[model samples]
Each structure stands twice: as C-alpha cells, then as structure tokens.
Target: MRVRNVRLIDGVSAQAVQDAVLECGDDGRITYAGPAARAPEPRPGVRTIDGQGGTLLPGLFDCHTHLGVPSDRSLVEAALLTDPVLGVLQTTERMKRTLDAGVTSARDLGGLPAGFRDAVAAGLVPGPRLQTSVGVLSHTGGHADGTLPGGKSLDLDYCEIADDVPGVRKAARRMLRAGADLVKICTSGGISSAHDDPDDQDLLDEEIAAVVDEARRHRGRPVAAHAQGRAGVLAAIRGGVRSVEHGFGIDDEGCDLLGERGAFLVPTLSTVFQPLDPRKTTPWRYQKKLRWNERAKENIAAAIARGVDIAAGTDAGISPHGGNLSELSYLVELGMSPMAAIRAATSASARLLGVEDTLGTLRAGYAADLVLCAGDPLRDIGLLSAPEQIVLVAQQGVVRKLTLPERSGSCQT
Candidate 1:
C-alpha cells in the first residue's frame, strides 16, 4: 500500500516533510517514507491512496489505559457487580472505539485481562495493539485495595492484595505467570480510593524493591508504579521502577531523582479534569479530584522543565476511552512544545513500552502503523481533539479507517 500527497512527521524529526510519500510492503513493514520526488515508482497493480494534503505521522500510543472496565461505572460496581461475560463484550466495543480514535498501540496499566491482548494479536478483535499488566499489586488499604467498611474485600481479577516484601514477591510472580507484559503496583493512594488521601504513602521501600527485583530478575519485565505522592515516587524510582504513573505530588527533589534515575513519568493529567457522572462519583472522590486539579499541571510542568522524560497517558478508564489524544493538549498546556507533545505520545511512549525498535517512528523496517489527519497538528494541537480531523488509521499496513475525498478517477497513476 502506498500513501501520497501528504506531509509527514516521521515521529523522530523536528519538522515535517512536504509532499511526502509512504509505502508499506505485503509483510506489514514500511518500505519507503520520504519526499515524493525522491520516491520509487509503484509496483504493477499496487494500491495507492491520495492523502489530500493531509498530515501523516506514526500511529499514536496511549502509554496508560484500563480497557477492561466500563467508564460510567464506579469502582465498586465495576469491580464487584460487573458480569464477567458482559464485561468482556463491553471491553471489546471500547477497543474498537479506541482504534477508531487513532490509537494504534496502548499499554494497559491495570484492570485489563491478558486475553484481550491475545485476541487483538490473533485478529479476532478490532482494536489497538495492546500490552497489559495483567493485574495490580497493592498493600492492604492501598490505592488498589477495594475493601468495604463491612470487612469484605472486592474480588477483582485485576487487583491483588499483597502485603510486605515476601507477599509482594509472590504476587509479582503470579502476574508474570499470568503472562503480564509488565508488572504494575500501587505505591500511593488515588482519587478513587475514598479511604486514603492522594498524598498518603502506601507501600514500604522493601516491598517495592522486592516486586521490582522479582519482575526484572525473573523474566526481564519492566515495572510500572501507581505513585502520586513524593515519598512513593521516590521509593519507586529508587527501587528501579521503569515508569511512574501520576506523579502529582512530586517536588524538585523528586524531579531530580527521576532525572538521575532516567525514569519516565506517564502523567495522567486528564484524570483531574475528566467529566464524571454525579450519580456515580461519590462526594469524597469529587473533592479529591478538585484538590489534585489545582496542582497537577504545575508539578508536571516542573518535571518537564527539569528535563525529566514525560510520556503521555490519559488514565483512560477515569477519562473516557477513545479520547486518548486529549492528553497531548494537556501536555502542551503544561509547557511542552507541539513536537515534544507529539513525541510524548509517539516515540517517547514506545520507548517506555520497550517497543521502540519495531514501532514508533515512520521509518523503513518499522511496522506500518500510521495515522493521517486533515490538517497540520503542529499549528493547533486541538485539531486532534476533534474526531472528524482523523482522516485515516492503519495498523500493520492494513487500513482500519479511511475517509478520503471522492475523486473523479482511480488513485493509481
């Protein structure tokens, strides 16, 4: 497949190539992507697509997502009351919507079952390429602990209640055995956990070290920590976590620690501003969101200023699925340049997921996952917020979504 008459960002370059042409081979890999004047001639009977002066770039990546649960349901209902079969069906539809929104790749931080990833890879579902952290490990009363006041704990497949160093090690091995691509753990409290404040530290340093050691040493998998407070963030970094999710309470010292350790921060800034149904969101959750909303941007901006790597993530289960790209606009507002913001969702995110070699950039020998927008996103990143602007989406050289202007004749030249 060949796509021509477009501007290309390539995801690695600082600028776009005008009148660019991109070619993908039958083997699902890019063959050529550069200025049209320097491109090779099309093979006989090959399909061609005219991009109509659109901007083509590498397919986007949502570094953090939870595709298993419905967004409208509260945590308690989603974990305890959701029917297993119905939940799978709902998640499948959400996956299609996510792909339609142009997210070709996503990392499920927690709450996603591994079967969805297998299904997408096997072509049984229409969705973005997925990497999952089968479940999340947390200490008792931590952010992931879903216990009721009556002493009954939530029986969620995605939540593992572990305590101390030995218990966490065992839980980490269980997740790895379950085919988790990465191990996820909660080191601090969050908005949804009504029992603890967002600033409350949850896990011990030894416990974090044990999980990280278990994950990294056993199968060479990376660990992602749900850390929002300063102490938790620092502990996760020191324990060799690969990424820190939601570092809302990080200070300068924490920023310096992150920079020194070379850990990427997947800031889910959209979580604070996400619209929630009043009937579902409790009063305490709403109050916690308001408090975090006030300082989330400032802390993330400070991290960017300190040269800490920032990757884009929406915490999509909190925000809505299919609106993953909205996080980029928030990053731009947090002082990242348009190109930088795009990179955060593209190349930088792929690096965080450890798939930079085969994905991310629009270069030859890479997977042919691409997206075409009606206008240049560099001028106004908000254009991405409008779903209509997404003209086409392709994964592994196969066209998944396309909306081109009706031409008078065939595209073949």
Candidate 2:
C-alpha cells in the first residue's frame, strides 16, 4: 500500500514533512518513507491511496481504560444483574466508539475478564489494540474494594483485595496467572470509593513493594499504581512502580521523587471535570477531593519542568469513551505544547507501555497504524475534537475508516 501526498509527522519531533509517501507491505509494516518523487515504482497490481493533502501521524493511544465495566457501580451491577451477555455487548460498543475516535491502542487498567484479551486479538471484535491488567489489586476497603459504608458488600470479582504484604504478593501473582498483561495496584483511596477518602494512602509502602516485586517476575510487564494522594505517590515511586495514575495531590517532594526515578505520570485530567450526573452517584465526602484539580495541574507542570515523563490518559471509563481526546486540550491548558502533547499520546506513551519497539512511531519495521486529519494538529489541537476532520484511519495497513471514497481511476505514473 502506498499513501501519497501526505504531511508526515513521524512522531519523533514537531516538524511535518510535505509531499511525503509512506509505503507499507502486506505484513502491515512500514517499508518505505520518503519524498513522493523518490518513492519506488509501484508493482503491477498494487493499491494506491491519495492522502488528499492531509496531515498523517502515528495513531494516538489512551494509556488508561477499563473494559467490561462502567464507572458507576450501580450501572455496572445493573448491567451484570439484568443480562450478562448484554453487559459484554455494551462493553463491545464502547470499545468500537473508542476506535472510531481514532484511538488505535488502549491500555485496560482493569475490569477485563480472562480470554477477553485473546478474543480481541483474534479479530472477533473491532477495537483498538488492547493491553489489559485484568483486575486491580487493592487493600480491604481500598479504592478497588467496591465496599459501601452501610456494611453492604458489592461484587468483588473484578478486583483482588489484599490486607498484607504476603496478600499483596499473592494477589499480584494471581492477576498475572489470570493472563494480565500488566499489574494494577490501588495504593490510594479514590473519589469513586464510598468507604475511603481520596487524600488517604490506603496501602502501606511495604505492601506496594510486594506487588511491584511480584510484577517484576513477569518479564516485560510493569506495575501501574492508582495513586492520588502525596503519600501514595511517594510510596509508588519508592516501590519502583513504572507509572503513577491520577497523582491528584502530588506535591513538590512527590514530583522530585518521580523525576529522580524517571517514572511516568498519567494524569487523567478529564476526571476532574466529570459531570455531576445522577448516574455518577459519587459520595458527598469525596466531593472535597475534586478541589485538587488546580493543585494537580500545578504538580503536573512541576513534573514537566523537573523532567518527569508525562503521558496522556483520560481515565476513560470515568468520562465518556470517545471523549478521550479532550485530555490533549487539558494537557495544553496545563502548559504542555501541542507537539509535546501529541508525542505524549504517541511515542512517550508507547515507551511507558513497553511497546515502543513496535508501535508508537511511524518508521520502517513498525506497525502501520496512522491517522490522517484535514489540518495540522500542531497548529491547533482542537482539530482533533471534530470527527469530520479525521479523514482516514488505517490500522495494520488496512483502511478501516475513510471520509472520502477511494478514487476509481488508476494510479498516475
């Protein structure tokens, strides 16, 4: 496949090359990338695609997501209790919406079941390239415990609740045995949890270390900590977790530790502005936690200044599925340049996810995942918010979505 006359942002930098041609082989790997005039002659029966002079860049990635689940426990329970099959079907629809929004890859933080990863990989469904964590590990009454304050116990199948170091290690190993691609640990309380405060550290440093140690046993799999408060963030960093999610109350000391450890921060900014809908049913005690929005932004800016790697993630299940792109705008509002924000969503995120060798950038021997837009994203990030501007989306060199129909005429030699 030959894509011609496109402005190429190779994911290496902010510069865009004009009149570029990207050639892909049958195996869905980029074989050639250079000036259109310098591209090799087409084979006798090869297909050609004209880019309509649009900007082409590596596809965006959402580093945090939850599948087979809803942010609201009531909705999740209702879906499961009413019809299990229908619940999975709804999850599939959400996945499709995520891909249609041009997110080529996503990391499922938790809530996915066994065999779900293989099902997606086997082409049984149309969705992004998925990497799953199975279910999160939390202490009893911790963020992932799903316990209410009225002594009512919610479903705990989606998470492993550990109360000690040995329990934490056992839980981490269990998640890996269940076919998780990574390990997710809830080191802090969260706004969505009815029994805990978001500013509190729920897991001890030793317990977090045990989870990280167990995760290291699985080669290539990293530990992701759902940390919100300063103490939790510090514990995650000290425990050698690869990435920190939320970082709601990350202070200067926390920022310094993250910078020193070279840990990646996935600040899910969309969660801050999540609407006050009845479906949310967030606890009133947790409402005070939302006030950390400004502080979180300041901490993120500090991290960026201190050379901490920043990646883009929307905490998708908390917000709507297709609205993940809103995170880019928030990052920019928090002082990240548009180009940097794009890189964070692409190359930087891939590196953090340990898939940089094959996925992130547009280069020879890399996956042919690309998104073509009508305008340059570097000039205005808002262009991404409009679905009409997404002219084409190609995954593994196959044209999955296109705004304009293919031309009928043969290639112009």
Candidate 3:
C-alpha cells in the first residue's frame, strides 16, 4: 500500500516532514518513507490511499497498562466480581477504544486476561500489539497480596502474592512458564491496593535481583518494577530491572542512578488524577495517587533534566484505557516539547519494550503502524487524544479504522 500527499513523522527525533510519502509491502514492512517528489512509482493494482494532506505519525504506544480492570468500577470491586466471560468481553470492547485512540502498541504491566495477547496476534481482536505480563508478584500484605477488605484473601486474575527471595524467584519463573512475554515485580506498593503505602518499599534487594535474573534467562525478557518510593526505585535499579514503573519519588540522586543503570522510567502522569468525573473514580484511590503530588512532578522534571529516559504510560485501568495519548499532553505540560512527548509515547516506549527496530518508526523495513491524524500534533499535542482528529490508522499494513466519526465521549482535558 502507498500513502502520499501527507506530513510524515518517522519517530526518530520527532522532526516532521510537512509533506511526504510512505510505502509499505503486504508483509507489513515499510518499503520507503520520505519526500513525495522522490517517491517510487507504485506497482499497478497496489492500492494507494490519499492522506488528504493529513499528518502521518508512528502509531503511539502505551508502555504500562492493566487490561483486566473495568473502567466503570473500582479495582477492588472488579477483582471481587469479574469472571472469565466478562473479562473477555470487556477486553474486546475496551481494546477497540484503545486502538481507535491511535495507539497501535501496548505493554500490559499486569492483569491482561489469559490468551488475550495471542488472540490479538492472531487478529481475532481489534487492538494494539500487546506484550503482556500475566501478573505481578507482591509480598505478603503488600500491593498485590491477594487480600481484599475484611481480611479476606483471594487472588485476582492479575496478582500473585509471594514473599522473600526464593518466593519471588519462583513466582517469576511461574509467570515465565505461564506464557509471559515480560515479568512485572512489585518492588513497592501502589495507590489502588488497600493494605499498603505507596511510599513503603516491599521487595527485598535479593528478591528483586532474583526476579530480574530469572526473568531475563528466558531469552532476555525485560523486567518492570512497580517502584514509587526512592528506596524502591534505588533497589530496582540496583537489581538490574530494565524499567521502573510509577517512579513517583525519584530524586536527583535516583535520577543519576537510573541514568547510570540505563533503566527507563515510565511515569503514569494520569494517576495523580483521572480526567473523568470525581464521582466515577473510586474513593480514597485518587488520594493515594495524589500522594507526594508536588514532589513527584519535581522529581520527573529532575529526571528529565538529568537525561533519564522517560516513557509515557497512563496506568490505564486505574485511569481510562482509551485515553492513552493524554499522557503525552501531561508530558508536554511538564516541560517536554510536543515532539519529545510524542517520542516518549512512541519510539522511546518501543525501545523500552525491546521492539524499537521493528515497531517504532516509519523507516524502511519497519512495521507499517501509522496514524493519520487531522490536526498538527506538534502545535497542539492534545489533538492526538481526539478520535475525531485521527483520520485513519494502519497497523501491520492493515487498515483497522478510517473515515473517522465524531468521538462518542470527550477526548480532551
């Protein structure tokens, strides 16, 4: 397929061509991506789509998400009541929204339903290219300790409780054997969990190291740690985890350590507040996210200043799944240029997931994942979140959505 008469963003440094052309083969790899004047002639019978002078960008990626949680309910409620039938149906519908929002790739940090990744890979579902972490390993009484209110303990589809070095290692291996593409370790507690403080570090150093070491043995899988506090962030880096999730408490020293360790930081900016109505959000949960609010922003700025790699994530499930691009706006608000914000959501995230060479750019031989957006994202990053603004989408050389309609719900802040 050929796309011409467009502005192209190649996902390198976010420098855009005001007008360009792109060509992709049936195998879903781009044949060329550059200026339209020097474009190669399309073979007869190869369908070519007119971009209508729209902006073509590398499809966005959400680097951290939990697909199992229902958008309309609290995490606790979803955990207690969600069943398999409901889980499958919800994932199907929820992921469509995610795809329509211009995201072609998502990394599930935890609680993605079993077999969902395979279904997406096989084209049974309309969704992003998913790399899933089956569940998170939590310490006893920690973030994902399997206990609900009233002291009742039961594991959800997304969490597994483990303790100490041996237990963490065993849990990592268990997830690896359970068809996990990546392993998630809760080195610190989080906002939605009822029994733990987000600032409290949970996993021991040995346990984190064990999980990282064991997880990487499966042909080099990446490990993401839920690290909120300074101590946990430090420990996760020291343990050699590839990325730190929800790094809300990282300071200048921690930023230096992250740069030194060559670890990526996924800051889910939406966690401090979901854009939806307050009545729709869970009680006390939003407050947990708001904890250390000022310091968190400062820390993020510090990290960026220190040249720590920043990737965009929404902590979707806890926030809203389809609003993944909103994180880019938040990044922009935090002093990143619109181009840098887009890179954080695209190429940087792809690199963090170890798919940079294949999925993140519009370069030749790269996956044909492109979003034809209506407005100039470089001028207004908020345009990216609007489904109405997304004129077309191409993932793996297949057009999944086009001729966009007015979005059902509001897409902007």
Highest TM-score, which number? 1
Pairs of residues clashing in candidate 1: none
Query: Judged by lDDT against the true structure, how good is candidate 2?
Result: 0.80
CA lDDT, every model vs. true structure: 0.86, 0.80, 0.82
RMSD of each: 1.8, 2.1, 4.8
Candidate 1 TM-score versus the reference: 0.96
For model 2, residues 1-413, the per-residue Cα lDDT tens digits are: 77777888887766778888887888989987767777777645666778888888888889998766665556446534757777788788888777777788888898877566677678888777888898898888888876666776667576789899889888888899988888999888887777676678887988988888788877857899999888888888999998999887787788778878878899988787665564356546345555676677777777766656888888887776777777887888777888888888899999988889987788889999988888777788877767677778878887767885554334652
Model 3 TM-score on a 0 to 1 scale: 0.94
Where does the lowest 10-residue lDDT sum fall in candidate 3? 404-413
Local lDDT at 166 for model 3: 83
Which residue pairs collide in model 2, if any? none
| Model 1 lDDT, full chain set | 0.86
TM-score of each: 0.96, 0.94, 0.94
Encode model 1's per-residue lDDT on 17-90: one tens digit a residue. 99999988989899999999888887655668889889998999998999986776777787778787888899
lDDT of model 3 at residue 380? 89
